[model samples]
Target: MSDNPGPDSDPVRLTAWVHGRVQGVGFRWWTRARALELGLVGSATNHADGRVLIVAEGRRADCDNLLALLDRGRSPGHVDTVVAQWGPARGDLTGFVER
Candidate 1:
């Protein structure tokens, strides 16, 4: 089987800064689990400034779905806003991890 994707399959990378009640509220854990379920690869890190930085790489639509989840945030962690940047996938990540 070819590892290469077909022309119709557009991969993407999403760098998102999640704000509001994200720190120590299971945000990273939820992100890691959800990302893996979506067959994504990347990492989620907690910033000292009370923000969660998530880098997700996957199919364009999957990445978008992940972002939507972040927008709603999770229970116990009310998400105020999600600042995201999207681009072509780099294919450098192996699996989703929380940091």
Candidate 2:
């Protein structure tokens, strides 16, 4: 990963799994909206084990903000336990899509 942030900065890849009462609510939509607002590129999907998987690519600060937002803006009866990993940076995604 490069240390410098530039105009052509590559998008940082992040894969996060949100646990707890994340499903059955609008968590996925909420995530997608936030990602779009932050100009992030990736997808958010619901796992079979009552967890939500999110793969987002964006700037370091934007990614960090997403994590914080997820933690803070959880829906009622929503509890999220997230685990994230950084991957190779990529290009800007077209839009946030639910899958």
Candidate 3:
């Protein structure tokens, strides 16, 4: 196996809006934990409209996994819908944080 992914492979950034019952429910904390576990770096915060805005940068597959996890919900909240916006990874974030 090679040590690098190759020229065609690149890090990915996700701007996801997790909607429905996501505020004031420790979802940000849970999201941070999950992102850290996936070795991703970015931030998660709650909007005043009851949606969680999560910006995560990492491997595409890992971000996908995180999306799947987010869609299924964790606890104290129900994830009704997930709006995903994918793009080139910024690679600027340090660690998972709450913003």
Candidate 2: tens digits of C-alpha lDDT, residues 23-94: 877888889999899989888898899989988888877987887887775553476567888877666666
Candidate 1, 12-81: lDDT as tens digits: 8999998899878788898998899999999999999998899999888899889988897453488988
RMSD for all candidates, in order, please: 3.3, 3.9, 2.0
TM for candidate 1 is 0.88
**Which pairs clash inside model 3?**
none
Candidate 2 collision pairs: none
TM-score per candidate, in order? 0.88, 0.82, 0.89
Clash totals for all candidate models: 0, 0, 0
Write down the lDDT that model 1 would get: 0.88
| Winner on lDDT (1 vs 2) | 1
lDDT of 3 at 83: 98
What is the clash tally of candidate 2? 0
Off by over 4 Å in 2: 1-8
Highest-scoring model, TM-score:
3
TM-score between model 3 and native:
0.89
lDDT of 3 by residue, 1-99 (tens): 999878436898999999899888888999999999999999998888889999999888899989999997664589999999999997788989997
